[model samples]
Target: MVRNPLRAFFMMLGIAIGIASLTAMSTIGESTRQETMRQFKNMVGNYDLINIEPGASATRGMPSLTTVEPTLKFGDSDAIVEQVSGVKQVADVQNAFDLNVKYRDRTTAAAVYGITANWLEMHSYFIDFGSVLTDEDVASVARVAVIGPDIQNDLFEREDPIGKQIRIGGVPFLVKGVLVTRGAGPGGSSLDGIVFIPVTTASKRLFNRDYLTTITVELIEPLNPEPVLQEITAVLRERHGIIPPGEDDFGFVNPRAAAEQVAEVDSALTRILTGISVIATIIGGTVIMSLMLIAVSERRREIGVRRAMGATREDIMHQFLIEAAAASLVGGVVGTLLGVGGGVIAVLQQSMPPLIVWKSIGLAVVLSIIVGLIFGLQPAWKAANTDPIEALRS
Candidate 1:
């Protein structure tokens, strides 16, 4: 019986497939979790600026002042920062609408932002070359531009881009800086494809619009965000002469809260995927059990001969159990190797992080052994109970 490599090979194959399936699922799930964390970190770092929108209840009291607009202005940002306590810095940004930027003969749809000097500090932006916009540049309305890495590579190539002029909406602005590669954000939006310019320059040269698209604010140290949010909301309400809270037109977001929400979503996804993988493992265990029972029936004569030759019931049980365990062990090893390889491939191709979880591997190995013991018990017991005289006669 021990010399039958062919039988053992087929048994091991089934267990191996089951283990591999489970391992692959776990690896992918872990990779997803890592990717989610990376994206959440990029979206909102340690803190967030709040955007306040009017609630529905406020609309009933004052129809004129309670009507909420869809947008907020740069002027509103300034008022909130100045009047609200616990507010440190304000970076008011305005977006250009459908602006066609031309670089000689090359042109593309570009997202242009008009940002304050503190935008670099607030966002922790590092320039690859030249310099970011200065306070003087903003005050003087300097027509300078900071291009993203994609724009630099596409339009500039190896040529020196600093001091080169690019036309946006037919207005020529000199290239002042090139931004370092920041890759893509969690929203799958390109972070390295836009252009940044001083808010004052954008206001004077382009849209001439007084309204701001968004404002990101930094809070003072040791201040709880909830109270700070309330203070900012009150200031904005007072400044806008908002008689009704429901009609307020602004919106606020806390980056910390957003990160927490993302974490919760990722946790739920991990649990769901993990549960499915576990079910696959269980199915594999069932297959192993069924196969073992068939093998016991076929090998009854061999078991009877062994018993007739002085093998005890305990010996027969141990032998059969060992064969089942050997199959599971082989499967566990092969599955772990395949899982690790698949994880590496996923990380390389999908921009997801490598998740090498030792605990998951350990759990998989332990589960495989447990599955062997549990599934093999009935077959091993049947082999042990074989009557030497009856099995021999059959």
Candidate 2:
């Protein structure tokens, strides 16, 4: 192997390309799955949390915040809390998009949400500083606001936002708290560019409507949302006076169902890519076999001389096999390192979390060695069977 530098490199190069592709694909697949779940959790909460939006079209996706729907009401939220058995907490929500938010001379557009006090907790949000909204704020219709990190930066900059008054749609509001940064949402929208106010204040003082945009429900027994879902559907249908065959006025977003959909898509893509990598590895093995056969032909004289010198057939075969395995092993190690670096860069480009699957790397190295032994068998046999008398005469 040391004497034939060019031949050894070609053998190593083929295996390296295949192993690199396999390892990198495995890393990317795992990272994508994890990142998708995390992003979903941030936007949709857990399986235990269900969001009910106005209009049947919401079943496909979240309803537009700008779409004016009068079908869902605040009473529906109260009824769910009182009537639904497995219900833990219910928060009524109303939202307005692209509202002009101003603090002194600074201004920016943001999504303003009118929410119950428990909205933050239900959505897994925490206050970075100051305080969250209280029941009193909603009841008394207090003109107070909680700002997101992006909102704080765009309007306040170096100034402290807490206790400072900011204007939303030209109405003055006291900044009660700032939320911990949530970064970008699942749909690539900015989650941090938002403002929260009491639902009552938004209805009476700002939008002046008697409706809600959505009702988010947290369940006690999350593993089975069917019973709770049925009950909620029944309550809403009966309250809205919808009979059989009538399309319901509300839609449900089940976090678990959404998660399953995402997993299916990711799984399909991963399988296709993995199959391609396997084919490449097989091609690499084929290349190794072809090259080794050529090497055996070129070195026929060496094999003949060794046989004349009383070197056993088994010894000649073993020597060739070991050379093949050594080349593959070195290539595997190099490929694994390169694959990990490539995977990290790919995930980072997609703004995904970096994750390494050590199990896959170990398996890839083992497989490379196995491929070397299997492909080298034919060449080893031919070298071992070379005749000595004819070669000496030549």
Candidate 3:
């Protein structure tokens, strides 16, 4: 039979497009999964921190009256830490209400955290300059502050901010240190856009409130967080003089639990994308089969001439099958190259590093061969069974 290079080239193009699309989709899906996991790890931190808030319980199984009231005081943090076991450290944080800060003349909206000296060790935070607030500052209610990277950049503008005084809520507080950048949280909270001051100073001078908004507790080891969490709950309940089996007005978060939830979401996303890739491959195979059938019908005279020239039925079938396979193989190779190039372009455009999984490339090549064999069978058989005498007359 005569070989048609043009027909084979077009057939290969179709297969190549399908494979390339699948490869691009898979690479993006996998990268998204990895980035999400990285974000989750950063958001939860390395320790368990319980958030205490006010709530009401149902009376007689009916909804009771609920009021927005404060439930925890600034002093309760130390009380709980002293009473509870397995707690390595506790830091009470109180955000200033309307912290209008000013540096020389410029001003920006910022969150002011009243934290203890142990805040650094409790939350895996490090100082980029100078030193953190110490117990001496907290005890003496000293007017010293530590600012985040964003705050430092906005306030000082390339100047060494340490030892300089910044006015917070009309009160002058000396800059003691600058915190290393912590990037952004999952909720878009800017970790490096806030300011830190002594808890005692903030409570007395800034907000004048005895209640703390949140308390962060760190454990000696992350592996045994459940026991530490339980102990914290028990101590808080006892401190508040709650009766047996009563619900406490607090919430606890475990990093391990958050990581597990993220894994479930990642798995679901993978399955959905994989299904879409499979559908695309099936459509490509159908197109190849249709094109092969048309080729067989158009080459009827060529088939007859080969048979008349002593070419066996098996030989005729083998020749056509090989042509179909060759078309698909060529298409698969081109598709793989295009897919890799597209993946690299996407990463560079998005400011991400490019990654190519060799296993995915191998899988695409194998699938292309299987698609050719399955779709080319009927067309090859039809050509092999053609009548030589009828073909010669035509």
Per-residue lDDT of model 3, residues 177-253, tens digit only: 99888876654466677788998898898879787766777777657666676777677777777777776665554
Lowest lDDT 10-mer window, candidate 2?
56-65
lDDT of 2: 0.86
For each candidate, what is the lDDT? 0.73, 0.86, 0.75
- Top candidate (lDDT): 2
RMSD of 3: 4.9
Per-residue C-alpha lDDT of model 2 across residues 1-394, encoded as one tens digit per residue: 6778898888888888888998899899989988887777777655668888876543533344454357998999999999989999999999899999999999999999999999888888899998999999999999999999999999999999999999999999999999999876566677899999999999999989899988999999977887888899999999999887888888887777788788778878987887888777768877888889988888888888888888999999998898778888788888888888899899899888888999989998998899889988888888888776765554
**Residue 392 accuracy (lDDT) in model 2:** 58
Measured against the true structure, the TM-scores of the candidates, in listed sequence, are: 0.84, 0.89, 0.81
| Predicted model with the maximum TM-score | 2
Greater TM-score among 1 and 3 belongs to 1
> What is candidate 1's CA lDDT for residue 261?
70
Clashing residue pairs for model 2: none
Error of 3 at 218 (Å): 2.5
Q: List the residue pairs that clash in candidate 3.
A: none
Q: Which stretches of candidate 2 lie over 4 Å from their true place?
A: 45-47, 57-70, 187-189, 305-317, 348-353, 384-394
Per-residue lDDT for 89-122 in model 1, tens only? 8887877655777788887667798988988767
